[model samples]
Target chain A: MTGVRLYFRYLGVSFRSQLQYPASFIMMTVGHLVVTAIEFFGLWALFDRFGSLGDWALAEVALFYGMVHVAFAIAEAAARGFDVLHRHVRTGDFDRILLRPRSTVLQVMGLEFQLMRIGRFTQGFVVLIWGISKVGIVWTLPKYLLMALSILGGCFLFVGLFVLQAVLSFWSVDSLEVVNLTTYGGVETAKVPIAIYKGWFRRFFTWIIPLATINYFPLMAVLDHQDPLNTPLWLSWLSPFFGIAFFTMSLQVWKMGLKYYHSTGS
Target chain B: MAQIVVRDLTKVFKVAHRKAGVWQAIKGLVKREYNPVRALDGVSFEVGRGELVGYLGPNGAGKSTTVKILSGILVPDSGLCKIINRIPWQERAAHVQDIGVVFGQRSQLWWDLPVMDSFELLRDIYRLGPVDFNDTLEELVETLNLSAFLGVPVRQLSLGQRMRCELTASLLHRPKLLFLDEPTIGLDAVSKLVVRDFIKRLNKEHGTTILLTTHDMDDVEALCHRVMIIGRGQILMEGKLKDIRQRFARERRFIVELGNRYVEEEVKGRISKAELIYLEGNQAHFNFDPTIVTPAELLHELSAEFEVRDVLIENPPIDEVIARLYEELAI
Candidate 1:
């Protein structure tokens, strides 16, 4: 069987086991939806009071929020194993993974499939549709394609961050708060327009971490809006590729960490 | 030909040194000391195909470290090691495809999933086809008697039951080589026997090369034909079980139960070339070399002097032999 088929099999087993506790599953899913909804409502109230933040309006900011959450939800669900990799490392379950015949990354990816994250995704989906309706952007085949690519790129970016966090477990089993600062902090920061942040913070997100590549730049291309910070339109369209690049780079770091684990026996 | 050959395999670990107290902890954050521990110091051994070799050692004697390196989960700092003609750490995926490992302390089975579900997932992980998987699964289930709790979740099962399922899970792939790291640890007599029996059959029937690392002497006596003793990160002794017994079996024990109360003078006068190791009201224990005086002569001498009501002649227990060996080697 192909790796993809095997991954789905893992997903099937994981989901079935999780479903064994129907009450807990339902409660967690609803709780996740409620918490995320409250967060969005807080943003909605801020937009209601301010009307517009500089050049960005409520709908434009909603587009950014929706894209980031949707991508984050999908990545968090699919890459749930990497998100909690410290537990596996600390408990020595990672040794079992190394014993398998499959690729470590693929096996780790298949370790979990958080079905409850569907609640978060659903909220993001509803908000995205509402934002599209309110923004009044004319729908076209190319525009829709760009939007799909942007969402996928955003998912890859978050997954990359998760993979990086997991790789750190090889060196230290403690779950560092710094990684959360980047991952959770990235999502909260990216939900707002990049132009509103300080110049250094904006540049850091753009060049170092590339959080803007998935949301801000792709949104600019989709909305046909000029960059408020005066960047080229073509560069904005290329932002989605940065997500793929970041993901690929993170994988190399993961490989190095695996090598370190093998030699050090940590 | 040997199925596994490890020569001069050495691994040194840099363990961080952490001192107690808030000031030391603060200092550790800035600059920490690392002490080098030689987990495997030029260890070397070999196991032929279809051979059940017992790898024995006391705690921190590098038994688990050797198993990890042999199974490809760890890489040695120096020396050559090969399993089935493949360098384990170099071609780990391919090497591990034909190998299975079980760590007694850790469960590879899913905690919340049924035993059957974990088996099915393992089937998929190993990519076994439907017909072949069914055939192998049926044989393992029947042999290991996993039908009773196949539907039960692993967390709910008893330790013995979970261990049986764990054994079955590892063999579903029908790996040519199996590494059992203390497979019978913390098991009752019945569960230990069941596991040992299954492992014996698996080795005989499937011709799987089995390397068992265990602290349980009974496990070694029951399952292994050949035994390797390791001490201080090195192979101290490697030979057949019978050879070890013969090497350490020079002294024999005799327990003679006297009809009347024990007499020290009578016991001393009759038993020559034998030291009375222990004495009670009516029973006396003697340690004597069989070569010096045969059991018949010793029995005759004791009976002729003292009114011996019963005589029990036995060899020392395997644990004593192992303990003595460890002490002598200063491991």
Candidate 2:
């Protein structure tokens, strides 16, 4: 309970510290807003010209895009510390985390909750509301529950991905950039419908990284149709749970990394 | 039964090999080589309750490795270690709750936050009660004289002010044991004295057992009850500063200042026991063993022959004692 409370306190402190430089904070927030706006426009233009990707409409694609960015922005703010672990390990600042009496997971999570990432979040939120309004689907308690669960599951998945990326810093700091394929690459793939991709790509997202479980499976359950791969409704509904399972597994790897770090004493 | 105990604590590190030049770097990438360096070799020691022990060693001499292990940050390859009756590495969070650590080379406070914010964060990290937290903070802040910069961000403060804040950061939880690794390194004279004074009072008043590792001999002299001199991954010697000095360097010095009427000629000859090490103008330096002949007899004999204006006696400086000890051990 204290860890959760402390995590929020760290967020509060981090927000105030970033406010110390108002100009930089304002500029970066605007940059994030502008950069994400451009990305949305690019996605919007493609749907405007082609009408849709395969059978999926712009409203549905907008839902996919919005859900991905919203969860990503939250994860970006929450996982800023893990995202910058390479620099921390290189500078020997990671030792500071170990010295603290709290769990390393909580310390790293609380390192930063960036306010600028809210710009990206705002854009995603607007698109999401617009997509939901246009979808014309009947509202149900389970559907509402599914939407919230899917977004939260996405957050957990992204946090896990961030932790996985950071785990490599324990052994070697070289070529850690390659792990971006799963983290940043996960974001790119999840923004589009899974059915649009080939069979192997879909399976890779579903099995290897579990990106499909959080975005595609839940979205299909919402649309009331079997995706191109014919995923069952029950499977789609349970897919968000798989994302949570993946989160716990990622933490297991984190444990191994910490043990290796202790033994190395570097 | 001691507050801190260790037996055969050892740690080894593997350093990867990378030679100069771009060609070698690329070739080395394909076939990397590693060299095993033993950082700690069969190092052992114990610190009783409320005992202030100083661990002294040169760079790469395992001073930090030992501190790291004891502070619950690093695990040794093989060792039986316990702090406050708990194995630090096995029960890290709980064990660290009873200890505080500060590394002089690094700042534990948040760079952008004010000093107080960092302290509050630490309070939450340790889950300290508000009353106990504030009590320790009040005492540390007042004693360390950190109220002036308490509101200022850490990066904006001077090194001295920041160091004072760092001390408060570690002690806010009132840990029974404190590990200070070079807590006074690179400070000016006044800051050094303030820090030394604070350390002295903390041990005296709180009975907090402190393990200090520093290059400054003055810190050891002013604070430590006992000292351990480590070199090349092992403890060369450990004892009181005076005892170590007597063992390593028994030869004491005597000085005689001749009156204005006398010249350097009167003080050039050897005395009965002391050796005339140097004769410059009217003052003379004589090296003698205190056991063989006392400074009083040397002064008396010099006064009988020469018109001695003034005389004084002194032991070797602490710096010389450590240097001689290091030399004798060939570390």
Candidate 3:
């Protein structure tokens, strides 16, 4: 409990520091907002010309895109510490974390806050609301709970990927592009339904990274949307948990990698 | 009883190496090579309770490797390291609770936060109590003279002020053992003295065992009771500072000024065992082997030849002494 409380305090401290220069903070947040808005608008234009993607309208596809991006933004904010692990390892900043009495995971999590990700959050949230109005899903207590869980579970899945990338920093500081593929690729794949992709691509994401379990399956239950996969409603409700499980397992790998932590740079 | 003990510590690092040039870079892209560096080889040492020892070495002589192993930050390939009855690497979180560390090259403080804010964060990090933490902070701040810039961000503080803050940060928990890696590097003369005095006091008062690693021989001369000189992954010398100086540096410096002014040629012939190093304007400098000619004999020979106004004999500076020692060790 104390560790968690201290982690929150560290988060607050990081946020305040990033806000020290108001002009810079506002510029960065606006920059993030504009870049993501333009990217999403490009997708919107593509759907505008085609009218519908295999009977799935832009609004229907927006549900997946917005939810996946929303979860990613939250994970990026929470795992900002892991995002800079490469520099930390190369520069020997990781030694400071080891010297502390707290858990290494908590210490690294407290390293940064990345408050500018709020721009991405805001854009995704607005799109989610827009998608909700167009789709007109029947409101229920369970559906409301599933919506919250699906987003949070998706956040954990991305957090797991971030942790995995950070673990690779221990062995080699230069080769990180491959892990970036999984995280960004996971977001891109989970945004739309899996029907568009076939064969190995679908299996690679659904079984290997397991992003679809937390995002696509849980989201389908919330939308009452049918798919070719024919995943049971009860299974979809339980699939969000697999994301949390993946996060737990990734932390274990992080522990194993720490033993190989050959500290560098004096 | 010894508070820290290590036996046969060894570590080898596989460093990927490539020659310079675009062709080499392209070759490295295809096929890479690694050079294994033996950072530590069968090293062994011990520090008893409250002993402030200096771990001396040239660059890349495994000084930091030993410190890292002792502090539980790095795992050795094969070794037995027990600190306060616990293996550091096996019980890192617990072992670190009783130890403090300061890396002069790195800043543990947040760049944007005030000095006090970082201290408060450390308080919660070590789970220090409100009353105990305040008392320690008050005493450290007052002694280190940090009150003037306590509220300023760390980036704004001078290097001297930053070092003081780093010392305070490491000691907030009152750790039993402290590892300071070049703590006084790049500080002004006055700051150096202040830090040296504080370290001496911290050891004497708190009974803290300290392992100091530094390039500044003045720091070692001022603080360390015992010194260990490491070279090429091995200890070349270890003993009391006085004994090491006496054993390695047996040459004495002699200077004489003649009573008759502007008699540069007053002493033409050299003394039996003394070699004149510099002679100009009625003053002469000679370096004599102490075992062959005593200071009194050299002075007697000087007065017999020229009308000596005064005579002075002294030992060489510690920096020169250690430089010669390093040359002899061929590190």
Candidate 4:
């Protein structure tokens, strides 16, 4: 109970701090909204011109885009400290975090709750609800639960990616751009249906990175059809678990990186 | 048992040697080389409760490294360090609950928020109860003179005010031990005095054991009862301030002024061994080796020979003594 209350207090302080510069906060929020909207607009233009990708329709693509953005926004808003770990490490601010009585993970999570991402969050949410209304399918309770879980799972997955990115700073600070190929690049690539991609790429996203679990499997479940690749019916429901597992594994890696950091004094 | 103890602590860092240029970065990834830098090599120290000890060393001399290890921020590669009966790294969360740390170069206070907000965040971070938190807050605000700046954003506060707030934030939980690394660096003389004075009062009143690492010798002299000189990852000397000076500065400085400006003449006997540090016409300053002669005898000899007007004696600067001690010990 105390821990939960403390977490809320941490968020409250972060919100107040960000609010100190209301104009900058508003500008950044709108900028994120505009920036994220461009990607969806590009997708909409492509669909309007060609009509569909393979057999996937506009609403199906929206589902993929909406779900992934929701996950990314949550992680971007809630786990921003991990995204900016390099700054903290370079400035030796991470040392102060260690001095605190709280766990480093919890403390870093509480480092910021970027209200700026709300711009992107609201945009993604609007697109999702719009897609839901336009699809015009019978919505069942289990499918609804799976939809919610998919978003939750996606949140953990991206957070895990952010954690991995943060862990790399413990060693070398250079080539951080390469790690971005996995995170921002992953989000960009995951926007499309997994079926349109080649076999190896599909396998990589499905079994390796598990991008399909967050979107395609749940989408297939919602569409009430068996996936052509014969991935088990239950597997789509487990998409969120991939993210959780990946995040847990990344946390382990993060701990190992911390140990290495202590030994190396970096 | 000591409140803090370390046995043969050592920390070695492997620095990756990276090649320059885009092409080199690509090639270097496949075949990288690493060089090892030993930061702390077989270092040892022990501190008792309520003892304000100064940990001094030159830049890159492992001063901050030692403080980091003791405070549980970093782990030593090969050694045993126990603070307050706990291994700092192994049980970090528990270990840090009773320890407060301040890095003067950085402000732990939230940069954009008011100082009071930072304090409240710290209260939550440490999970102090309402009554205890209020009590500590009220006492700290009054003693540290933070009322004028508490409501102001940390970014707007002057360096001195920010430092005072930092001190209050760190002490709100009332930890048993406080680790201050360069807590007075880059502050005005008044601010430095305020920080030093507050530290003195805190130590005197609360009996909080403090291990202060600083480049400022005055802070050491003013606050620390004992000083430890470290260099090259080793303890060179640790003792009372007076005792360390006596060991290094074996001479006493003597200043003399004549009734009138006159041609300088060489003095014989005890004053000859004394080095002439300064000479302005009739007024001359000589630093005599105390082992060979005493201040009284030297003054008597100088008074008897020359038509002296006034005389004054002083000790060498502690910084010079410490420098010489470091050289002598090869620390």
Candidate 5:
């Protein structure tokens, strides 16, 4: 509880610092909104031509897009410490964090609050609510709870990916573009049903990175659609569990990276 | 029992040697070689609680490596080290709770946040109770004269102001031991004096044990009670600053201005003992060993022989003294 409280305080500091530059904050937020909107429009155009993507309707895809972006935005806002890890490494600012009498993970998570992501978050919420209304799905309390859990799970998974990217900075200072393919590309690929992808691609993301567990399987249960792959009904609902498991494993990697930091001297 | 102890603390770093040019860079990925660089070689030291020790060294002399190991930032390959009955690397988080570190090259204050906000954040990080937090904050703010800059963002403050805030941030938890690495680097004369006075006060008032590292000789002279000079990952000299100066003290130079320039064949006693090093523009530099010839006696005899206007004594630089020590020790 104390850790969470202190993290909130760090977030509060970050938010206030961001608010100091109102104009820049608003401009970046708007830019985020436009960029995300354009990506969604490309999906909408694809649906217009094909009418649906491998048994997935536009509303279904919107549901996936909205949830992934929402989770991603939350992670981006909170895990920006990891996002700018290179700057901290180069400037020896990480030394300051180490000197503090707090968990380094919490301190880094609270490193920065990108207020500009509010724009992407706001747009995601609008798309999510619209998709739910248009899909005409039966809403039960458990299903609603599952939806919330799925978002949380997705947020944790995305944050894990961010953590992994940040840890790689210890070895190489330059941020690689391949990591973005996993994060940004993961989001793009998850929007559609995993069935749309080839056998190799689907297996890679599902088994290796586990991107499919956040959206595809959970959406299947919510939509009451029978999956051709014959994954058990209980297993489909357990998609979020995989995300939590992966996050726990990534925590070990983060610890190893920290030990490396001490040895190398940042 | 030693509050801090170390034996044969050696740290060897494997650094990948990279060649210049794009083609060489491409080739490096396929074939790379790493060379071992020993930053600390069997270097050892011990300090009792509440003792303020100044660590001095030239650049890349492994001064920081020692500080890092003691502060639990790095682990030596082979060494027995402890701080307050705890191994620093093994019990890093616990060991660091009672220790504060400040790197003069870096600032701990939040760049975009006010100084007060940074302090409040630190209070939370340390999990200090409201009473203790407020007391320490008040004391630091008052002693450091930080009330004026409390509301200002760190980026907006001057270097001196930022440094004060940094010191306050590090000390918010009231660590028993403080490690200051080049804490006075780049400060102006006034700021340096204020910092030195504050450190002295911090030591005397709270009995905060301090270990400082610096290249500035004045910092050693003004603040350090005991100085340890290290070079090539080894201690070259360690003793009282005044005592070390006496050991390597050179002949003092005296520049005399004559009322009138005269081609004197010889001065009575002055020419006999002193080396008249330079003579130009009605002035001369006399290098005289104070042990051999008293400066007063030489000045009086020289005045009797020639008209004298003014005289000034020059103390050679402490850097020269340290350089000579390095040559003698081959460190």
Candidate 6:
């Protein structure tokens, strides 16, 4: 079988094992939906009190929030194995992956598929539809395609960050709070317009990490808005490609990490 | 031809050193101290194809390190290792495709999935064709008797049952080489016998070259004709099992149960070239050099002296031989 087909087979087994505890799965899913709903409500209350922040209206901020949360949810569901890779390394389970005749990345990618994240994904989708309706922008075919591309790009970016986190386990099997600063903290910062941040902060996400390429620039292109930072309009249209590049780079780093892997003692 | 050749392989580990107090832990964060320990020091050995070689060593003797390097999970610091003419760590994927490893302390099967589910996943991972997979699975199932619990989840199975399934899982690809690290470490006598029998048969029938690291002497004695003893990261002895025993088999133990209590002096005067090591109410133990006095001569003298109700003769245990070897070699 091909790697892709084997990946799906691993995912199928993971889903079945998780569903064996139906009650716990349902409870966790409901809990995820409720917590994200309250978080969005808190954002709505702030907007209700202040109408606009830094010249961006509530609907524009909601579009950013919805896009970031939706992409994050998808990445969290698919890349959970990387998110908790320290446990596998510490417990010596990573040795079993080495014994198999497949790429370690493919095996780790298929290690987990968290279906409960669908609850958070649904909430984000609902908020996105509500924001689009309230914004009153004429929706063209290109605009719709751009929006889909932005979500895909954002998912790829977050998954890349998670893969990088797992790669760090080769050197140290600690909790890796530093990588989380980029992943979880990046989600909160990307929910707002990158133009509002200071120059270096915005540049860190734009040039160094390219997180803004997935959401901020693509959103501007789709919303037909001008860059307050004076970036060329053509640059904004090419932002989505950053996700693919980042993902490819992370896979290379993962391969290097495998070479340096010091498997736990038996 | 030799299926595996390891020449002067060595590995050193830099372990962090920290004191117990919280103040020391705080100091460690600034500039940590590291102590270098040699886990494997110029170890070398060879195993021919279809040879079931027993790898023996006490704890902290680098047995597991050798297995990890041979199985391609670790890169040695120096020296050459070639399994089937391929460098293991350099071409890991291709090398591991023909090798199977099982660590008794760890389970390769999925914790929450059924035994057969893990097998099917391995089938996909190894890319075994349907027909080949089925034939191998059927043969292993028959040999290992895994049909009863194939549908049961791994979490609910006992250790023995889980180990049986693990053995079957590793063999599904029909790997030419097998590395078993303490394969029968904590099994009951019956389970150990079953596993040992299966391994012996597998080696004979399929010509699978197996290198087993085990602490169980029975496992070593039952399945291995050739044994390699390693200590302190070096091969101390490697030869046929009987040859090592004969080399160290100098003393014999004799236990005699008397019909009535006897004085120590009375027994001591009757025996020659034999020392009475221990004496209880009606039982006595003797350690005698077989070269000095034959067993028939000693037994005849003992029978003439005491009312010997029972007598048992035994060679010194293998554990004693190994412990003495370790001490004598200072490993």
Ranking by DockQ: 1, 4, 6, 5, 2, 3
In the range A1-266, model 1's lDDT, one tens digit per residue, is: 78899889889988988998999999999999998899989999998998888888888888898989899999999999998888888888898999998989888998889999999999988888889889888878887777788889888989999999999988876446779887889989988888899999999998999999878887888887878787787876677788999999999999999999899876
| Candidate 6 local lDDT, A68-124, one digit each (tens) | 889999999988889887889888888888888898888888888899998889898
| Regions of candidate 5 where Cα sits further than 4 Å from its true position | B259-280, B296-314, B327-331
* Ranked candidates (lDDT, high to low): 1, 6, 3, 2, 4, 5
Candidate 1 recovers a fraction of native contacts equal to 0.79
Q: Per-prediction fnat values? A: 0.79, 0.68, 0.60, 0.83, 0.58, 0.62
> Each model's DockQ?
0.79, 0.60, 0.60, 0.75, 0.62, 0.62
Writing each residue's lDDT as its tens digit, candidate 5 over A1-266 gives 39899889988999999888899888888999999988888988988998987777889888888888888888888898887887898777787677666788898999987878888888888888888888878978877778788888888888889888888888777545668888888988887777778999999889999888887788888888778676677876788888888888888898999899888875
What docking grade applies to model 3?
A: medium
Per candidate, the number of residue pairs that clash is: 0, 0, 0, 1, 0, 0
lDDT of candidate 2 over A104-136, digit per residue (tens)? 998888877889999999998998888888988
Candidate order, TM-score descending: 1, 6, 3, 4, 5, 2
Better of 5 and 6 by lDDT: 6
True contacts kept of 3: 0.60
* Number of the candidate with higher TM-score, 1 or 6: 1
Instruction: Please write out the lDDT profile of model 4 over residues A143-181, one tens digit for every residue.
Output: 889989999998998898888898888776775788788
Mind giving the per-residue lDDT tens digits that candidate 5 earns over B93-194? Answer: 788889999999988888888888888888888888999999998998899899987999888998888888888988988998999998888999998988
Reference-based TM-score, model 6: 0.96
Best by DockQ: 1
Compare candidates 5 and 6 on TM-score and give the better one.
Answer: 6
Model 4 residue runs over 4 Å out of place are B18-28, B259-271, B303-305
Q: Answer with 1 or 3, whichever has the higher DockQ.
A: 1
Question: Best candidate per TM-score, number?
Answer: 1
Give candidate 6 regions above 4 Å deviation: A262-266, B263-270
User: Candidate 1 chain A — worst ten consecutive residues by lDDT sum?
Assistant: A169-178
| Candidate 1 residue spans exceeding 4 A from truth | B263-272
